[model samples]
Target: MLFKKLYTKSLFRICPKILSISSLRYATAPSSYAETVDLAYSSYESTEDETSVRPPVVILHGLLGSKNNWNSMSKAIHKSTGRKVISIDARNHGDSKHSSQHTYLHMAQDVIKLLKKLEISKVSLLGHSMGGRTAMVLSLLSSDLVSSLIVVDISPAKTSPQIFSMVNLFDAMAAVSLRSGIAMSKARKLADEQLKAVIPDINLRNFLITNLIQTNTGSYSWRVNIPALKENFQQNIASFPSSLKGLQYCGPTLFIGGSLSDYIGKNDLPEIQEYFPLAQLQFVDGAGHWVHSQKPEKFLEIACSFLKDK
Candidate 1:
């Protein structure tokens, strides 16, 4: 819980601009990489590398989230599991390159490319929200490359109508203007005012604003590609592809849902099992959609226990 306490304390250090929230209902496209998306990633190696034998864990963050969001958790996982942990910035998010196309298939391919480029033969994947969908699709397309799949607070099925708050969040972010040379303070103030109407939760607002960065010119800019994401919002919020209907990942899988979150419900199990036949569903008591952040200790226990199983 040390990292959880530290994460909470760091939230108020400086005010920043907001990012998009989870909007989880849409359709998927065919599984083909029309273009290669350059994904950016960071790795955490075990302290005693010579003794480490666990399969590497690759983490994918949610919509509007970057590899940076998983920094603390990645370190913790590596320490506990003795496995190399790699966290990536999906295309158009964080330091990754922007592209005109944004779909689960495309994103899944991006992850595959990164793994291949790193020469990692197999990995255990952990993804949250939109990242969860990407992980599912990737497992279906390349089951050989995935050792285990852990989906956090998201289902393969269509999301509920309430998830559309992300659409409103995106529209609000797009409306904010960050003229060149503006101070970080003023930019954050303006952003807070605009985001307040759409996103009223202080903690959620803090989580989203972490994506805002101060440019070399003193103006604030989002680390995420806002315009591209907004334009391809529908694809980004899509469900696992229907094209993968008959394909099922027989590998060990886990679905961790937040007890207070409706993103993953009882109705979604059939669809989840249809693709992930070995999936085990668990809920984190007293947590919401951001389950890991809300209950880091419990999340870590569940994750490490699952990953360490032989």
Candidate 2:
């Protein structure tokens, strides 16, 4: 399908399809997002306004998360604004393509391919954690495709290496031996035990365990490329390419950080300004790294008001 406007009366309903490839397994969703069927990605579109020509807004989730991760926020945003919203499954995490290598460049390209397939000329972007980095790179890689950008609790500066100690949590979970006949409940219990010390939130623990899937052979395994993620963990926290040195996105951008999260601090503000000179910064009180999920109402308020403003 070429570039065109979608009516509010038509709600996109994607039907799930399972596909097997030599490289990886995929669950494809079919609907109106894009006409192309072979692309390995999933999307949820929610629209409200019938006459408004609001630019498409795409939401990208963090590492180890799928498009479903933004189900709540995407629905909320769609209900609040009559504009189209798309939540995408980034590569290696969700139903998207799973490769042995994970890098910001490759992830950003996956999003770009999705947008191209949708024939989206321009879009507003909101990303969390690793997703935030992808959005930042997207703006640099395909500036014209991005109308506005929102980076949640992340900056271009190199993040502290110590933060990735959490990978041990994944290691611990992988260490748990389970057969194909084992139930998810048992797998959940084992993963919880491994992650209990690191993740205090039961809900978050469950969210991570959702990546664990039952294989066709009845074996339980993680959907994510754990070894690839482990190897690229440092690159995930590393700075952007030097070619992006002088690149500055002048769009209506917002940089949101958590009050309790050290990921984005006053020290990182200058570097952020250097890269995103037009960015507006807001720090959410009583929130941490997961600022948007932690303070949805405030995040929505800020986002809505910003988008509405000329």
Candidate 3:
């Protein structure tokens, strides 16, 4: 129901599928947003008319989140900025194909392949948490592909203690046995109940439970690759690559942090500015790592203002 509500109101009905070791192709493109970029103005009202074609905005969701996480905001952003919006399902999450190797580089390349398949030469990127890191890496690796960037509640430096703490959450989820033949609703309840043993926060459990999907054979399973995530979380996901230290993306970048979240510290500013000298930072009060969802209006206002100039 959580995703259903978001999808009903979202302007985008289809999302790009990312594959590994295979050709990039649309999973199901018929009767969707495949044929037209200029037709995105039906429900969304364009505020500005530009003589030059503006780059499309490609939105990336965080760990354990799908493109639908940003669907609500995508509509508003397209309405405000008058640009095409493309929300993606990163590999191992959502509708994308899963892979054993999940790292920033691998994820960035998946996005690049999708962009190349779509023939998008230049793009504006909006990403959150893990996806934010992917955006930063992509910007640094292919500076010409990215025109502008918006990173929400994440840093380019080493992972914070809060992110490390997520290891326990993943461990707890892995211990849960959805088993076969259980109804999807019952499986969700069981997963939530079991997860509450280690993670007391019902809100967090419910958020994670949205990843549950019913298999074709009347079985329940999580869409995200838990075993792979567990194997690579600490070394790969939790730590930023040192090899990318000296590299930088000089494109216009905006970093938005949540005041209530410890993901971005006061000390990380120098490193961020070093990698992105043209970077700008903004914070929303009473919000956590999911700043865009927590404070949609303010995040949108600030984001739209930044994209307006770019």
Candidate 4:
């Protein structure tokens, strides 16, 4: 039954920009119209006295993920490298303010603003999936602000076919019913039933459902701005910008892929090297798209080594 539903969804495709008003009627209006997003973040600073010598690391999560996802990892990184770690909740995700517009340009700018606000002159950036793409764009747009870059399981070439599956998942989430004052358990049960029909993978479904939160009124809502994300899927998330084609970021860069994930393949190396001339690629065994989460030890080892290297 789930397979049949997924097959039917795969046949339905629509341009993200052409979303009708009815499609987004459930979404609330954005609080502001500013081009720059005011990002919310958490910091992990080293307890040792030598913290000043270690460069700060800024971590960005993927789509539908919040800074809280990186909490443990950030602490681990800080402990290992004795560096300050900042895990940011990108706009429209976690505690950050939602906006009608979401793009890599705006996301990258938001990161810059956060850095300035924190008085960080330069940082080592580590990003996963959508965040990886954001880091790449930011490195190219403002190379001076980034000392090093680590891109996890994502390429800047083009959108992978895997992204389309997310559309179906979002559609399923939007279809779930959640009246005010509904029990959290009941809401989750309802959402899971609807999501299971479209997303068969339990891990993915679990990850997506983390965005579901109980509103003050006791109704279920999503921490992420799903409507904005859905609307900008093709225009932003699904494609790399054409304007950045000729641009290059000549900093030390590492591209980490999961052996089981098709997000990054050998064929992608040329384009990656084209944009990041000093880039090196590596892969973690027995892992998928969520490489860091799946193989935390290996991911952290590689990450700390790369960041520590001069």
Per-residue lDDT of 258-292 in model 2, one digit per residue for the tens? 77887777567567765676666777778888776
Off by over 4 Å in 2: 1-52, 197-204, 236-238
lDDT for each candidate structure: 0.77, 0.69, 0.75, 0.79
Sort the predicted structures by TM-score, highest score first. Answer: 4, 1, 3, 2
Highest lDDT against the true fold, candidate: 4
Best by TM-score: 4
lDDT of 4 by residue, 141-218 (tens): 677888899999999865678887787877877877777787777777778888898889888888888888997777
Q: Higher lDDT: candidate 1 or 4?
A: 4
lDDT of 3 by residue, 1-310 (tens): 1110100111122222223221212212211312211111112225463324888888888888887667789888988888878888887888888778788777777787777777879989889999999898788767789999999889986476878778787788778887889777889889988998898888789889988888888777788888888888988888765556556677778888888888886567777866777677777877888888888888898889988888
Give residue 164's error in model 1 in angstroms: 1.8
lDDT ranking from best candidate downward: 4, 1, 3, 2
Which pairs, if any, clash in model 4? none
Worst 10 residues of 2 by lDDT: 1-10
lDDT of 1: 0.77
TM-score of 1: 0.85
